[model samples]
Target chain A: MPLVDSVLAQYFEDALKRADAMAPDYALLWQSLQAATYGGKRLRPALVLSAYAGLGGPDPAEAAEVAAAFELLHTALVLHDDVIDRDFKRRGVPNLAGAYRSRAAGRGVPLEEAAHRGQSAAVIAGDLALTGAYRLVAASDLPGELRLRLLEELDAAVFASAGGEQLDVEFSLPGRRPSLQEVLQMSRLKTAVYSFEAPLRAGALLAGAAGREVEAVGTAGRYIGTAYQLVDDLLGMFGDEELTGKSNVGDLAEGKCTPLIAYARLCPEWQELAGLLGGTPSAAEVRRARNLLEECGARGYVEDLVECYAARARAVLAEAALPAALLAELDGLLERAVQRSR
Target chain B: MPLVDSVLAQYFEDALKRADAMAPDYALLWQSLQAATYGGKRLRPALVLSAYAGLGGPDPAEAAEVAAAFELLHTALVLHDDVIDRDFKRRGVPNLAGAYRSRAAGRGVPLEEAAHRGQSAAVIAGDLALTGAYRLVAASDLPGELRLRLLEELDAAVFASAGGEQLDVEFSLPGRRPSLQEVLQMSRLKTAVYSFEAPLRAGALLAGAAGREVEAVGTAGRYIGTAYQLVDDLLGMFGDEELTGKSNVGDLAEGKCTPLIAYARLCPEWQELAGLLGGTPSAAEVRRARNLLEECGARGYVEDLVECYAARARAVLAEAALPAALLAELDGLLERAVQRSR
Candidate 1:
């Protein structure tokens, strides 16, 4: 883990060595970004390494740049995710954009323009990290063909995510909701593949793993990623805000098309809270929305979905006959991924 | 030109063929995007093909896909440019983001939230186009090494542009302003390299041109691109809305970091007007701001700067000793690039 941290740190120092040459403020932005990633879980990077090591490859150290690439990509997604979701906080603090917004406000910029500037800054920040993700892959010291394939994989994942994102926007519109099955499909396309499948496969591919092993890891990724998102949706409804590093009512306020929301739409009893789903729902309204989710069986439905997918993921890992220790690591991963739901 | 158009059209058809399969609304968004590119100047695509043919390439037809890639890259940059500038119009019409915002507003969505949604949609639209640009290159019929180098060139240009953009934001801050030298550097980094250098060098690179020739084209592109941006900045302040398809007052209202603004910061008489730059200046204030720009000789200063870069670009073209026809074509290109200044 410290090796991962050191690799990321070195990437920042070298990749952004030109930042100071470009401009001091630009350097400051990159410095702040480096700081932001330092204290985080590095989950995506871990997946990349674990998948690499599990597939009978070279040392995990050789996979470091690829791991760093995914971490940067995840950072890009989270930054833009806040812009789309219009949330201001991350990890109980003003996020990257929010920090800039507060800075402008402190400087007496008109509130509207300050907010606009903040969002604009974040967009550029995400763009920087997004392209930096590709640059790292190019710098990965991997074979050229493998590097190209990694880019291709990353592209497919982003393409799927962009599609899912557009669908998400459409579903938020009145009378324009996707079906529950569509929601599940969107969740897989939106979150599962990119969050799980892409990193796992990239790591496997880099290790020169067998096709069967690569395919097996991808299948495992799909199931685990689906479970991960389902649990996340449940947490959005009921998890402690402090624990999740998110507002408990964000999904309700943003009208996110989570599986639970999809199921809630099927229940007549949930109609009243549906109006509050995307609006500025108060704490009391969120509590009532929670009750509606409980009464209408949406919560139970989501929990069952999570369990089903988690079980499928476990089954895939067992049948693949990966190292027993690797299987145990994956088991721990699955448990850690879903345990937040409670 | 028609070949380039057909290539782009076919790409949209096939690439987005699966969009409707992903989500109908996703298909609609791509449809809107395709329409958005239809009426543009096609200058970047032209540069790609022109540079290819001028370099003694066997055929311009082979360059079509790469040409289309540049157009998409331009489109991606412009979409985000609107979001950053908070500009509502493009070519005298509601820009892509503005149109979406209008639609949301028409649906009785609250004005502020609708605006936020519109910007969010634009962010995703840009992201889609950005990734689609890379996908086209991967899908190009060019040799592998050439394609890879093209990506490297593109990566550098985008990296420079991002730095320029961040610097642009920093300079727009009230207490922060770039020197005249910094403004010129930012203009080249922000616009010229991406707009002119990358596309031109891409065409030549695809034609198997040599390193010296390729580097010369980049130098020419810098002069031309900076000149083009200077002319554009002037148009933003002084050109007729009917002629430019943009209000003359937009630069003042947006508080852009144009060379003119850079000069105005030096004039004591322009101090009060500078405060009105980024705010909602009234018509009378805009008129006064214009007067101050002229009175303080900032407008003349920018015109001279444009002429300087334009002449420099012509010199680079002549010195490069490309074919006479290529030089003449570049002469025509240079004229076309900055003619709006008159």
Candidate 2:
């Protein structure tokens, strides 16, 4: 196995053990936590570790705990995000709310009451996961100043992401279409910085990287994160459900105003597409909307944007004063992130 | 002004400035923040600074930022708590939700949408306050280890408080009334520890106090906190509205399962009170319920509990090895905290 993979496996084992020990009686909370944590692609942790390696840091084992911390935080966000978005499934399985609702029904509660209870439980579970992330970082063997800095970065990312979520929720309302630039800015703050830049910067900071090296890693992270989110937006619209393990049409169903949707709005044929985009559109309407997106060249436009970001990511990586081997690995990850089917 | 008050006033000014600079465009967010912070009695920050001084530590100014941090965190909790309770008013003024609801109406939005937008904004505002608390602590001049410890304490308090809140919410539902002991435990975790112990301990830790001294302060804090909560219960049931700034009969009307209510549940003669307190009751019904509480000796029972905790607080203060002058002030503060009308 690769170094990052080996370290991540051990990290997950330890994290799961710690989570289990935290709540012995809350069996459902434990199970939901395991489901959220165990199946992730580990992109955030890999970014952190890669940044550390790029900064001349040795021993992937040393970065494993921090990696675990970032992953725990991400999982916590996902669980809460699903609840906030009213998502019923993730990775083709019942999400936390769905699982808890089912459990409550088995105990003979009314449906609405069961779902309310599930939401309440999910909120606390997310809080516990968030606290666990901090606990992991606090309990790490890292130096105190470094730990504090890492925590500060984590805190900033959380706040920014939360603000982004607020904007995303607001954009769902009528007459509130944000400008495309605003959308990209929100995406960068909400997804790119936390999902990519902050974690990588945190890892590099932990490895004592300073000045231009740190700045370069952050730049690389931003490019890669933008590309990753662009791909995610594309997949949300057009990916196969069997492969992506998502609703495939979920974002459209939710009326999410992604970059592709925003571009579609700018086209001359937007009036037709807009009718099919928002509210409860039929399956046929959704198919037509997807077809409209392709007809208007939105899909191609977004794909081109993703490629541009991916190329920018490569250029940034090339400019970073890091080891050739680490640079190559990071370049590969960026390409794979933007090109992956699922 | 007393040393603790002087320090807190200065700290509050600086912290507010920092918060303003962080996000200038979010004016309503800042106003809600100022309302929550400035409306508080400054008891928590007083406890912290006083504890630092009680430990014979000089330079109380050094603890100012952290004192402000605790106050900010406490305010954030209050904002969220008000929302969770669907409270329209707090501290005799419109709450964040109420204010935002009015603003949305002024903007010509529909009622339901406005209310939801208000709730969403309040959530984001509370989150911002929560994040601001950590930022203050992290950027303080305190030593890194001390700062980390303080942050950890605050985080743990938040988790415990959230857990307690969950329990409180659950207890409000039919068929889920926990035992009186469990209620007290929840109260201690939710209100006492964070509101009293953590702040004091944070101060002591920052002032270079030893473990034993910190523990002793915690003991004193627990006693004071419990007594304070007991008094709060008393105020909720029987205090005059003008003095308490809350409906004297509000708890009874809302079917709040507080300590007094729990004690009433155990008494056969108080069965009438239970029926009245089962759900939303009329103002007249609330008045009659209050009379029943007094008549059935539930009020007297709570009074006795308050006295016991207050005496325990005084005894703990006497036992703590601290400067005599600081001890005297803390004792006076504890007495006033329980004895004050509002």
Candidate 3:
């Protein structure tokens, strides 16, 4: 585990202790939250730490704190996103929300009531994580000025993410099909900025990097994040469940409007079948839909777009003044983002 | 309106303009949030301003920003609370969450789907507000140290409130009724501190009030807030709709284990009727419930608790070194908290 991960581990241990000491009501919630922080790429926080070190900043401690903050923010957003989407699984396992829902059922709460309790717990759990993210930064030993600026960055991400979330939800409504352009924009706003731009820029800001350097990192993150989303869109449809750790057919069943689906809608070969996207198709129907998507060249189109973003990321690296170590790391990230099977 | 209220009004006007410029997806949400801010007594924000002035803070601009922040926090929590409680109305009107739900229904969306969308919108809307509240303070003109310390205060409130919210949900579960001691702690954590302690301390901190003065304001806020919740419990059961602007039977129908109900559970006169507290009683049953409550003297017990809190607030006022102007404003606030028919 990295520095930020260790810090996060210690943070949760102490936090859960305090919360439990305060009231036993939140014990399960705290435990679920702990489980949530256990795995993942830790990508966002890594970006924070990398950016801070890359920019020649003196405070690894502050960078670690900020990194943990990003992770918490991501956790809260993902938790809430699952609730809105009614998803019960993440990374091939029951997520924090799912765990609560399952617990309620295991305890013999009726289905609807159990679901309600699960959602309630998840909502409150997410609320705790969201505030905890801000609390991490607020309690950091960093000078007040540094912490304030970082908070401003954090807030900007939250604001932009809200707009993105609104767009995502609005576009996903039944019988509401958004344009390809809108999907791309929403993708950038909803995922790319927060995942890529926020962590990278936050790191740079902590390092006291120049405005231009921070802007360059943002551009790099945008391209990289967009590429990553494109790949995710691919994996959701074509990847194996064993590798992706997801049902893979969920995007189709949930009627998620992804770049692949949006582009497929524009293709004459797939346009006729596009209406079946969210009809909760059977397993056989999903396979047929997947085959059609691939045969119609929609997958190719998305792959090409992913390449475009990857190339743009390279272009940014060529021009940015970031450290060599940072550039090498970003290159590796880009490779993983665009080429990962999962 | 007071200076803080006007400032809040202007702030929203500008914020709405900016949000509209960014995206139309949030237009309805922003409008409803603006509506929610209107027509209230502006109690929490008023406390912020009062505490700031009482602490001899010269910058009304900073005070106004903090006041608006408190109002935003309150609005967000209330919106989410309604979702958790499944209430659709607030202040005799369709609140932000209710507005979305109603609009969806009006558009002929199916009942279940529309309700889902409404809840989804409310969740996101509240998230936006919560993040927006932090943004306000982060973007304030206060010095870094002051803002940092203020954020510590803010984070503490959010942390405590989250625990309080969890306690509230757990206690309200179908078969579990909280003890009177737990109820009082919940009331203090959920209402008193955030509504009273937080804003008051925030303002005092911004004004650079001495530690003792800040502590004094916290004590004053606690007593006042406790009294306010007690009155709220009373009004929920006994107050009229025309004055209280709510379906007073809701507290009983929802089986809210308020202090009154807790105490009444021990009273022999109400033991048989106590089981009906959360049974979604009919209009006549509600009437009978009310009369029984009064007859058993449960109302008097709650009234006595309210009086005790009021006296404590008065005692804090007598000892606190707050300015005379602030003391007068607090006196008026205390009167409203305990004496208002609503």
Candidate 4:
């Protein structure tokens, strides 16, 4: 296994142990947290550790904690994001809200009451995870100045993410579809920076990397992060639901102003596509929409965009004055990310 | 005007400037924020600056920023809390959610959609305020260690606040009347600590006060905070809406499990009180319930409790090794706080 992969595995194990220690009751909250933490691919954490190592960060164990903090934060975001998006399933299983609703129903609460209870519980759980994320970072033995800077970065990313979410929600309204540039800007703010750039830059900052070396990591992160989000957009519309562990074409139903949608809007024939967006759509309608997107060459356009970002990421990595081995590993990861089917 | 009051005023102006600078074009968000920030009584900031001066802290300007940060955080909390509580009015004006809802309705959205949009906007707005609070603290010229410790305390208080909210929500359910001790615990965690103790202690910390000095503020803060909460509880039950700037009897309608309710639950004729406690009582029912509370001596009992806390606060202030003038000012504030009808 690559060094970053090993670091990530170790970090995951340690994070689970820390979470267990923090919530000893092993109550429903802990159980739901464990399920959420273990469900996703550890892409964000891996990015953090990889960037750390590539920038000469020593001691994988210490770097792992930084990685773990990002994962915990991500888990909190995903849990609360699911609630905001009104999603019922995640990772092919009942999400926190769905599980809590079922538990409340089992206790014989009215359905509406149960749902309210579930949402309330999920909100609190997300908050706990957020606190837990900070505690992890604070407890790390990193230098005080470095830790503070990392924390400040994390805080800024959180605000940016919330801003992007607000814009996304607003853009879902009829006649409110943002421009393609705006959609990409929102995606970069909401996902790319936090998911890839911030964590990576934070890891590098922790390692005392500075000057051009630090700038290099940031540049590389931007490219990789943008590519990661473009791939995610493609997956949302085209990937297998069974493998992605989320609803395929659900973004279309939700009228998400993704790059694909933005590209489709450019075609005269796709003007009617706007009416089909928003609210839940049937499987057949989703299929028809998918065909429409393909007919407009939107899917191909997004794929080309993803590849362009991927190549940019590789070029940045190559130009960076890091270890060749580490750069190669990151290059391989970027290639896999863009090419992955699920 | 008192020195601390002037200092805090300047800080509020600066903090508002900083927040405005961060988002110049976000007119709706900024307008709503201005309304929320300017609506409150500025009690929390007053307490923080007062406590800092009482402890003989230097640089009241820096102390004022710390104070303003706490108040900003409190504003954020109130905005979100109103949404959670489904409150329509605050300080005799439509709150952020209500105002947003009205705007949405004016734009021709359905009532329910308008309500949801209002809520979503409020949530995001509150989030921005919360982030703005931390930004204020982080950007302050305080000592690094003190800033870090203050940030940690703020983070912990946020977690406690969220936990307390969950407990409050849980206690509202049928057959779950918590004990008076539990109510106090929740109050301390949710309101007292964050509203008074943490901010005061943080101000002291930023001033480079010794541990003993900080501990003294904490001791005094506990009593003052308890008394403050007691007054809040009383205001919820009996204060005039115009004076208090809150809806009369709304707490009772929302089934708030306050100390007053806990005391009422202890009466021998508690069954009648219980029936009237959590329900939306009519005007006659509210009058009768008020009569029952007075007849059962619950009101007097809570008043005596407030007096006891007030006395303890004075004693702690005397015991603390601080300037006599500052102590006298704090003492005067505590007495006025207890005496305030609202």
Taking the tens digit of each residue's C-alpha lDDT, what string does model 4 give over B1-342? 244345445545654464344333234555677678777777877767766776766767767666777777787778767656766577667888898778777767788777766666666676666655665666566766777787776765675576566566556665566888878777766677778778778867866778887877777777888888888888888888778766658777876888888888899756787677656799988888888888888888889889989988888878876678667777877877798743
Q: How many residue pairs collide in each prediction? A: 0, 0, 0, 0
Model 2's TM-score against the true structure: 0.87
Write candidate 1's Cα lDDT for B59-109 as tens digits: 888888888878887888788878887766787777778877887788777
Model 4: which residue pairs collide? none
Residue lDDT tens for model 2, B67-139: 8778777877776676556675787677777777777667676886676566556655665666666666765
Clashing pairs in 2: none
Docking quality tier of candidate 4? acceptable
- Full ranking by DockQ: 1, 3, 4, 2
Candidate 2 chain B has its poorest 10 consecutive residues by lDDT at B19-28
Model 3 over residues A1-342: C-alpha lDDT tens digits? Answer: 367878888888877887787777766578788788765678899888888888887868768888998898888888788878877778778877677777767766677877767777777777777877877776677776777888877876776676677778777665566888889888887888888999999999999999989998888998999999889888888988888776788888877889888878777866656656775788888888888888888888888899999999999889986789888888998898987843
| Model 4, runs deviating above 4 Å | A1-40, A61-65, A99-109, A131-145, B1-31, B138-140, B268-270, B273-280
**For candidate 1 chain A, which ten residues in a row score worst on lDDT?**
A135-144
For residue B254, what is the lDDT in candidate 2? Answer: 69
Model 1 misplaced stretches (Cα beyond 4 Å):
A1-7, A138-145, A275-284, B138-145, B275-285
Per-prediction RMSD in angstroms? 2.6, 4.1, 2.5, 4.4
Candidate 4 lDDT by residue in tens digits, A135-188: 566555776677778777677566666656666666665456578877887787
Clashing pairs in 3: none
